[model samples]
Target: MIRGCGRLLTMRTAHRVETVRAAEAALMTRLPEGALMQRAAAGLAAACFSLLGKGRVYGARVVLLVGSGDNGGDALYAGARLARRGAGVTAVLLGDRAHEGGLAALRAAGGRVEADDPFAPLATADLVLDGITGIGGRGGLRPDAVPVARAARGSDAVVVAVDLPSGVDADTGEVTGEALRADVTVTFGTYKPGLLVDPARSYAGALRLVDIGLGDELPGVPDLEALQHQDVARLLPVPGAESDKYRRGVVGVVAGSARYPGAAVLAVEGALRGGAGAVRYVGGAADAVIAAHPETLVHPGPPDRAGRVQAWVVGPGLGDEPGVAEVLASDVPVLVDADGLRGLDPALVRARSAPTVLTPHAGEAAALLDATREEVEAGRLAAVRELAGRYGATVLLKGSTTLVCGAGAAGAVRVNPTGTGWLATAGSGDVLSGLAGSLLAAGLRPVDAASCAAYLHGLAARRASEGRGPVTAGEVAGTLGEAWRDVRAGE
Candidate 1:
C-alpha cells in the first residue's frame, strides 16, 4: 500500500492509448518486432507457471484461444514456451488470420494449432488464456466465436485474460455482449476503465497490471479516480485542541417523517459515526432521532429554524413532506437523497450559490433526469455528469460502483473503489447521506466530501461482513470508526 497526500492516484481510461503507444514506440525503437513479442511471451509464461502452483509444467495441459492481432501473438508465443517445457499446448484460432510468426514459433516448440476443435483439450487443461479479443474489439463476441468461448467457460480450468476480457469496452467500461469471465486479467502498460468500473468490472474477477514501463508519458490529469485508504486518511478531518463543537463544523439533517422515523435514526447514526463535531436534527422524527442518539440536538420544527450549520442533509425518509424544498433552498452545502430527489427543479438548484450534492440511486436519478431507470443504468457515467452539469452541483450516483462528478469548468469525475455487493441493502442510502453531509460541514469541497464519504462507507460495510453473512445498515454505521482507522493506518 502506497501512502500519499490527500490526493488520489488513479489510472484514467483516456490516457491509456497514449501510454500504450508510447511504450510500443519505445520498445520498437530499441528492440526488433520479434524481440518484444518474445519478452511478452516470457513474462506470460512465468505468470502462468507461477499461477499453477506446481514447479513442473511438464505434464500440465495449456489451451490458448488466439485472436487476429498482437494479443493473439503474445498467447501463441507463450504457448510455444509452455510446449518447450514439456507442457501439452493447444491453440484455438478464432480469427481469419493467425499471427504467422507466432504460429511458426509455436510449431517449432512443439505446440499444435486446432482451430476447429470445439473442445480442444480445454476440460483437462490446467489454464486457459482468453486471447479472443483485446482492447480494440467492439460490439460483441463474433457469432462464430461465442459458442467456443462458452465451451471454454464451462470447463474447470482457471481462465486468464490477456490485456482485457474480450467483448468489454476498454474506454467506457461497458460490456456489449457475451464476455469471457476470467479468474484474473493481466493488463499491460496501464489500467483500463473496464477493469475498474462495474458491469465490465464484474467480468474482470481480479486485476494485475504488468508494468512494461509506460508511466512517464501518461497525462497529468485523470478523468476519473478511485481513492485508496491513504488517500481517504489524508482527507479525513481531525479535531484540534482549539476547535470547539461549532468550529469543528455543524451538520444539519432534515430527514424522516411520522411514517418513517427510522430513516432519521439511521441518518443521525451515520453522521455521529462520521466524526462530526455536532449534529442538528430538524424534522418530524426528532423524538425518534433523540431516542437513538442522545447526543444529537433535535429540533421539532421546519428547515428555516434549523439554526446555523455548515452543511445540510435533506430527504432520506422525507416522504411527501413540504419541508424538502425549504431545506434545498438553504445557503449551506446540501445533500439530497431518497424521497427528496422527487420533483426537483433543475433550474432552481442550478441557480443556488452554495454547493449541492445529489445522491440518487437508479430510480431516483431517472426521475430527476426524466429518463427511464434502464437508460440511467445503461449510461450511468453520462447520466450523472449530465445531472451535475444541469443542476450546477456535484452528483454522486450510488450503485455497484459509486460515480462522483463535479460541475462547471473544473469538473472531474471519480469512481469509488471501496464497495461490496452487500451494501445494497435497504436504509443504506440514509447512512451515506449523513456521512457525506458531515464531511461537507467539515469544510471539504462537495466532490471531495461525497467521494471520500462513499469510499469510507463502502469500506465499513466490507469490514463489517468479514467474509461472513449479510450485514445490516446499522452494522455498516457501527463499523465506520474501524474503517477510519484502517484507512489512516493504510490497511
Candidate 2:
C-alpha cells in the first residue's frame, strides 16, 4: 500500500489489453527484433540489483521462474545479464517449451537451468524473478508449478515480477485462482489496469513502470487513471473571504429512518467536514441529526421543500421510499446510496437531467444488475460499467478498491488508490455519500466529486487507523478536516 492519499504519487494511467497490444506492435515494427526485449531485460536487471540489498551482484543467487512465452524470455535475458555480472543465476522452467534464444543467452552467460528440486534455490535466493506467465495469462498457476510459486513467495528473497504477476488478469484486476505475489513488479511500456486495482493489486506489492518507448504509439485516452494529491487539491472547493454559507455550497441530507437515525448522524458528520458551507437536513431523523450536530439547519418533511440546496445526498437509512423520486426531480446533482438503491427504476433515474451519482457496494451493485454478489465481485469492472450505463449515472463501486466510472463506455474509469480493510466498519458508506454529495454541491462534476470523496474518505480512515486499532464511521468522518488540510498543504 502507498499509505497516505495527499502525498505525491506519479499519476498512474492504465490502458486496455487491445490498446497495449497495438502500441507494442507499433513500437516493435520500428525497433529491431530483440531491441525491446533487451531494453526491458536491462531495466529488469537494474531493478533486481537494487533489491538484492547487501549482497553484490557479483555473487548473489538469482533464481528465475521461467514459463512459456516472451515473459520467460524477458526473465531469462535479465538473468543472463546478471550471470555475466558474476551473479550465480539459475532458471527453473515451468513448462516443456521455454524461450530457446533466451535459454541460449543464459547458458552462454554461464547461467544454468534446474532439472529438479527447483524450489531449493528459491528458499536461499537473494532475488527471485517471476516470469511464470505474463500480462496475457488467464485463470491461475498451473497445477504442476503451484508449489514452486508458493515457495518463491514464502522465501526471504526479494521478488521482482517481469511485466506483471503471473495469474492476475491484466485488463480486469480479478484474481481467479492461485497466483504469484511479487514484492515489486517491473512492467514494460505501460501499466495494465490490473496493476492499479485490488485483488490483483494486492498481489503486486510495489509497482515500477519501465518505459520502452511505447508512449508515442499508445492511445491518448487511457482506460483507467488514479488521481494524485495535486489533482485532488485542484478539484477541492476553496472558499474565498467573500464566501457565505449559501455561496460556498449547501448540501441537503435526505437520509436515516426511525430505526436507524445514527446513519443520519454519521452522514451529517461527513457533510459538515466536507467543503460545503452548510448542511440542510430533510429526513425523518431531524431530532437525532440536530442532537448530534446542533449547527445543522434542520427541516421537516420531504426534500421537496428543503429550502435551496445545491446538492442532495439521498438514501443511507431512508429505506426504499424516502421520497427519493421527489428529490431527484430537482435540478441539482443527487447521490443515491444504501436502501435507496432498492427497487430503483433505471428509467426514472435516467429521466432526471441533473447529474446522479450512485454509491453501491458489491451486493447493492449485484442487486441493481440482477446478478449474484459473487458475479459482481468476480468481475467488478464489468459490473460497474454496466450499472453506470444502465442508470446513466456516475457509479462509485465501494469496496477494497473503490472504482468510479462516468455514465458511459467512453468515460475513463478511476480506481481509488487509498483506503484499508479497517474502513469496512458500519455507516462508513453513509459518510462517503455525504462527503461526495458535498463535493457535488461545491460545484465539482459527478466524477470528480465521487473520486475526490473516496480519496478523502480513505485518507481519513488511514489516519484514524494509525494506531492499528479498529475505526468507527465517526472516526473516519472526524479525520476529513486533516485530510483536506493535507491535500492543500501539498500546494
Candidate 3:
C-alpha cells in the first residue's frame, strides 16, 4: 500500500487480539521495564516533529487525549518529549485514572493536565493526539469523549491516532458508534488488521509503521495479506514464442442482455485487456458484442455449444433469468457477478469440480448472506469468509476496500491495496468480473486470479483517474494495459 518507485511492498496483517497480546508479552519479557514504551514514544515524537514542518515546535500547541491504559501512557510520554522541546503540551484525561509514570514524566517535562474545558484550547491547537484507547479497545468511543473528538476534527489542527483509532475494532475493521478519525496514524511494531482493512482503514489515513522490535515476536503466518505489484506480475500469464490463441487461454463472456448491450461490450473490453489470448462471447447480445469489438468470437446461443474455453464470466446485465445455470454447468472455472449472483444455490457451487469465484459488491453479498447491506459493509471480513465457506468458492467483496477470501481455515483473506474512490462508477464491477475470469482462464488459482484482478482493476482505475478526476468503466478498462505495465515495472 506504500507508494515508492521501484519497490514491491507486501504488508502482512494480524488482527487477532490474542496474537498481538502474545507478541507484546514475548517482547516485553526480553526488554527493560519501560524500554518498549520509550521506543514507541520516541518514534511518535519524531512523527509529530516531521508533521510540524520545517518550523520549530517551540510555541506550537499539542493536545493529548489520555485514557486509562498504556495507550494513554504512550501519548503522554510522547507529549512530554514534545513539551521538553518547548511545545505547549496538555493532556485531557477521560478516565477516572491516568498512567501514573506518564503523568509524572509529563509534569517533569513542563506539560500540564487540563481538568476542565479541554475543547477551549483544542480550537487553536496545532496538533491533537488521540490515545483514548489502545488497539484492544472494543465497541466505540464513550459518551464523555465524543465532544472532544468532534472538536479535534472540527479544528484545523492535525490529529494523530496512537496505535489504532479508538472505537474501531482492531480485528474486524468494524466501526460502531463514535470514532476519532486521524489524518495520520503512527502505528507501533506491526500493522494491525484494522489499519489495512476498510471502513476502519479509511479512518487510518496515511499510515506510518514504526519498528519497536516486535518483528521477531510476531508469528510466521498472518491473518491477512495484501498483494503488491511484483507478486501479481509473477502470476500474470506471459505469452511465449511457442504460444498461440489456444495455448495462452480463452475466456468466455456470458453477459449483457436485450436491455443492456453495453455491459457485454464492457465485459469483453476487460477480458481483451486481461491476460487471455482471445475472448468468446455468448448470450443474446451477440450482435452488439460483435459491433463493439469485432475481435470477439461471437456465439448466438447458450454456452453449452459455444465451443471450448478455459474459463467463463457470467452475469453482468444478463437480467433476472441470467443463464448462469448453463454456464455453471461448464467444467472450466466460472466467475459469477451481478445477476448471476441471484438465485445461486450453495449446493451447486459446492458441488462444482472446478474452481468457483464470486465477485460481489456489498448489496450482492448482503443478499447472499441474508443480511443487510449496512451489516455486510460493517463486517466485510466476516461476510466474505461466510460466503466463501458457504458456497465453497473464492469470494471477492468489492468496494472502497476490496477483499478476497478463500475457502478453508488456512486461507488468508487478501485485501486489495490499490483502489481509488472514483472506481465506484457504474459498470466497474462487470469489468472486474471479466478481468478476474480472464486471469482464471490464464492458469492462476482462484484466489490469485481474484486478488490479482482486483489489484490491477483498482490500479487501472487509479491510473485512469490520474491523480484526481472522475473515471468511467470504459476508461478504466482502456487503461488496464498501462496499469499492467506499471505493475510489471514496479513504477
The global C-alpha lDDT for each of the candidates, from Candidate 1 onward, is 0.82, 0.89, 0.88
Candidate 3 per-residue C-alpha lDDT over 303-400 given as tens digits, one digit per residue, 9 for 90 to 100: 88888999999999998645798988989999999999987999999888888899989999999989999999999888889999899899999987
For model 2, how does the per-residue alpha-carbon lDDT over 359-474 read when each residue is reduced to its tens digit?
99999999999999988887888888999999998999999889999976446799898888899999999999999998888888898899999999998898889987799999
Give the winner by lDDT.
Answer: 2
Q: Candidate 2: which pairs clash?
A: none
TM-score of 1: 0.93
State residue 123's C-alpha deviation in candidate 1, in Å: 2.8
Worst 10 residues of 3 by lDDT: 1-10
Question: What TM-score does candidate 3 reach?
Answer: 0.95
Which parts of model 2 are misplaced by more than 4 Å? 1-10
Which of candidates 1 and 3 reaches a greater lDDT? 3
Q: What clash count goes with each model?
A: 0, 0, 0
Worst 10 residues of 1 by lDDT: 1-10
